[model samples]
Target: MDAPVSTSPRPWSPPPDASDVVKSIHAMLHPRNIVVVGATDKPGNYAERIWNNLIKYGYEGGLFPVNAKRESVWGVPCYKDFASLPEPPDHVLVLVPARLAVQVIRDAAASGARSATIVTSGFSELQDEESQRLAAELQQAVRETGLAVTGPNCLGNLSAGEKLFTNIDDRAVTMVQGPVAIAGQSGAIVMAIRQTLEDRGVGIGYMVTTGNEAGLETTDLMNYFVVDPSIRVIVVYLEGVRNTKAFRDACKAARAAGKPVIALKLGASEGGRAAAMAHTGALAGSIETFDAIATREGVIRVQNLDQLIETTECFVHAVTPKGNRLAAVTLSGGKRGLLIDAFDAVGLNFAPPSPGISAELGAMLGPGSIVGNPLDAGFAAVVDPTVYMRAIKLMIDDPDTDIVIIDAELPKAPHELRERNLRRVNDMAGEASKPVIYVSAMSIGFTDYTKELRQTLPHVTVLQGLDRAVTAIKSLIDYAALPKQVPDVASSSKPSARATLEKILKQAEGAALDEVDSKKLLKAYGIPISKEAIAQSAIEAIKIAKSIGFPVVAKVVSPDILHKSDIGGVMLNLTTPAAVGKAFADITARVKKLKGKPKLEGILIAKQVNADLELVIGASLDAEMGPVVLFGSGGLDIELMKDVALAGAPLNEADARALIGRTKAGVKIKGYRGKPALHEASAVKALVGLSNLISDAGQRIASIDINPFLINPKTGVAVDALIVLNNEAARQSFDKSTKGKSTKKGGGH
Candidate 1:
């Protein structure tokens, strides 16, 4: 019989809906022909192991070996180089030194090979100038030749779908082919996860290690997995992603395809971030940014390896609970207490047995048996084991039960009895709409037969520990409840506002806009600001303060100073003209004493705002995810606690309302602990306006900082404003302001 031919076209030969780059990646992952570069007769070498694994795994493709010093390698005829091959192979595994890897890729490209896996290191991971230079060279070769490369320092990939195994581990040759596709930056993690999954009998379809990611990133593989018919879930062990746009696109694609992506991303902690940077040369982005994107994209994030495996095992049952309500049944009363505590800690709700159901259980057990959520069946289960099944069946059939969890000390029981009990439970679960997860409370002491029972069982999950079980259960519920709406990330609108903002940004100077001009920009977006004026001297400051009214606020205006109060640059409650005049002189004198001798624009005199609460609202552009909005407690504590909530910008009022509600600061705004309830809607409106500002001037604006935006029941007033512009925008604004300007001041808000 002849080997089957791949329907997939060659690299650079794209289908109608795909591009050449995507076609190239597809061929690399699922190739029909492969040639081993640097193939040798030496036993246990990387090339020898890969070549033998291909044959052992029953790879149905043309295999050619390239070895300059040998005529034959491992009983296969060896060619001298790519020029000597009979035909162009679909992919090549280049096991050469890092310095020579680029040349090998160029040779492969010239020979018409679509892809090459450069199994070499000493590139970007070193975090030095020379390594980075080499990495850049590799990237240039890939871009110039249009060849898809997996790594310059990586463990090769394995495609069980094609019976292709090139990873260092020969065990991959025998792993079962299934729906899960795993991709990562660390080769060890990729192989470890595969082994863990395979140990539990969960087969994998594709496993790829994107070391250094100079040419291909994890996102690229995710995008491909989204469309692959053989995959139902995508798992990734990520340090970080340099290409955030690609990550977002791939996540969205997976969501659209109804494939869930499970990510175990590192870099949430300082130590983890350092380790990740050292290991993969990944500049870990803000953890908050990663979390926000994950939430918006419906990607499931787990903390550790244990959760990864357990959650995946649970997903294999493929049951999506309708709600978080859980019905738990345990054989031991002590175990019931532990289970209840674990569930409560993670916010899983309990479904208490109805009165009639409780009464029935009471009569059946006769007495001393509690019939409630975490139901502790009577000691009758010890003598009559049928009682366990009966109690569990009743709970499973409850109308309020979205999930059923059973905890049992199976290791203490005879294997025969435990297997019988579990099999009956499995049968019951298989027929129900909700998923059933069994908690092995004493998993450490479990018999081998019991462990085997868990591994080999169909549609049955035996989670090891109580805490992990609760988390898995909660994650299952959260995934089921993920909102279906596509995320709206700053859709372009407000053409008039965009034009005005662009003009203003184009005319600004230095890094920041002074208070007067910042207020002018905010007013354009409909945010209310106190009437104010910039006064050039003491007499001018007195006159402006009087016009604003008595008890006005005076702040020193400068392009350099960020925190006015810290530098004694602010004076509040200036009731008299003399006090206003004195405050202006005092601010100027203090600012002059500060280091760097900041250029003071003028004294900004504004009517003091009286409000029920103070709030801080800010907007900034994230390098990875574009615009982001921040809301937090205002006043001096803003920096102390840093208690803030964040959301991607260009949001509507409803989204803004949800965003503000996420923080402790928002709690106080809504009348927490005997405090009067301030109008929260006013703040929401201000946030929406800020979002508009970001969307309108995103290219020109770097950040917008508004602290202590006074808020009352009906309105929010910007007490102060500071807008930072990008360099080009700042330079443009500086040129405009410096040319033929007398006072270096703008009109009032």
Candidate 2:
């Protein structure tokens, strides 16, 4: 079952000491000896396949198989249990029924096994009471015995460098060791990624499937890979993260070591989240929060398997580009057009050729070429292959180009023309100062000859399909352009400011604060709010409206009525006292006629402020990620537009500005069409204030919404505000206080 979301503060704690986790994970991945607990030679048995794989892969360590029913299997002795073994193994593979898996782990631990992989299912993933009890017992076993465990519902792991293969998949037999390490929550995804990388000539150094992650999580594997010397890039396929802080730290460590980390994360859509929950019993957090974390930590996120494979290939083989500028040369005009379209779709543009370079290409290609960003070399290059190399050289030499691409293909079999042309392009790429990549017109599998060509030109980066190649290029450039420093959370608020907010919260009675009280909270944080006041009667409302200004806005103030305008409780452009009085009477009468008699808390009379644009800025406590701030287009159609951006809060100035820039409201605020630019600095200040407010007292405040925050050229003002308190937290606080008072009275007696 999914864990309940908490309203209290869930402060992120630092991960366990790095050296300790790394040491434990290293032992699990590179065990000295392995024992198969449920090993048998019965047909279609998982343990039998795993036992064969260990022997087939040439594992040099000791391998002991245990089964009470079998005397001997495959010329190896089968023991009854862990107690009967001659010596304790360092690792144990448990492939028994769910009811017996916990006992097997206990036996393995008692026999001095340091780690184990539980391949049995029926744990928390089953989401039944019995399954949960088993899961709890397994967790207790690991904690009591200090045993490093991999999974209770997962395939086993593999260490390519050590020739240790414990996985049950058939594809594990052919995985070649390389510099890339793969860690995933799903076993099938791990094998699929491993196959794709190896098929594309990218070797895999390590593969780990952290199914259910009963004891060891994907973050543990990530920490290990970051410190390992042989690994250069880390690939992760995750349904959800167990520890947010540890995950961030691992990504940061990889970035510091100059190793790229690519993630293919699920749970962006509702169905995907449901599937993840059913598959692994993981509570998938919001995708926006994950994206914010990924961006902050400099991790590359891919949308699909193709993008993951293609992006990984580029990072492994190609040099990082200095900028987004690109230049390409193609032999066919149609291919060039497709390249342009692909690049444009991803918001990338090719570097326009310099006049000198364009003229030189025009003269050299006999005026048949239309030279631009993606220069087409024309059909003449088909006869005279030197044209391809010379054009590539000029494009690479151009001052504006940061990376160069050339459309070409490797021959499936030895052909004189194709081989000669490919060789020339390879030699040029070898010497070019800028990064150069080879692109095929369409996606194709590698033939034996293609593999041979790749071996010869190990430095050349080859990408298939125009769309996938361009997407990968964008990832490469974006990764290269990331800032070196991760922005820290905005500084804490002053003690006086925090104390004032706390006092207001303690005095509030209901779950939600009315607009007047909400504005009071905003004003304490230095956020500009509309000039408003609450009036108990129509005469008082008219008196306040006249004092504020001639034209004013009157809104009903009630904790029960969140959407006041929907109940005809809001009156705008009240030009006189008569109008304000009538609005107050109308709003109260409408509330009285409602099906449920909601308690009316008078009306608010505020000055009407003209705005150039309407925007929403708010902050709330995320169950997993803590405080998060949201900004988007506001007004009644806020839900319909759905154009917004979210980021984990306590945001610095730069983060706040970047969050705004991600939304469409940011574009309109920057003088869209003939509109003059509004006060964006004011908006940034408000967002930063809201972020800091939530971070300071997020335990008490459930959410703070400032919708339709009207902005003009001069400043921005919060026209409507709503603050929802964490009702659970308030009750807990009250209970604690009452208990303390009762204890003191009893002591006095």
Model 1, position 673: C-alpha lDDT score: 84
Which segments of candidate 1 are over 4 A away from where they belong?
1-22, 127-130, 170-174, 268-285, 409-414, 441-451, 487-493, 673-676, 726-749
| Residue range 130-192, candidate 2, lDDT tens digits | 998999999898888777888877888788766778988876445456889998878888888
Minimum summed lDDT over a 10-residue window in model 2 is located at: 272-281
- The lDDT of model 2 is 0.78
Angstrom error of the Cα, residue 23, model 2: value is: 1.1
Error of 1 at 432 (Å): 1.1
Model 1 Cα RMSD, Å?
Answer: 7.6
Question: TM-score per candidate, in order?
Answer: 0.88, 0.89
C-alpha lDDT of candidate 1 relative to the true structure: 0.75
Worst 10 residues of 1 by lDDT: 272-281
For residue 439, model 2's alpha carbon misses the true position, in angstroms, by 1.9
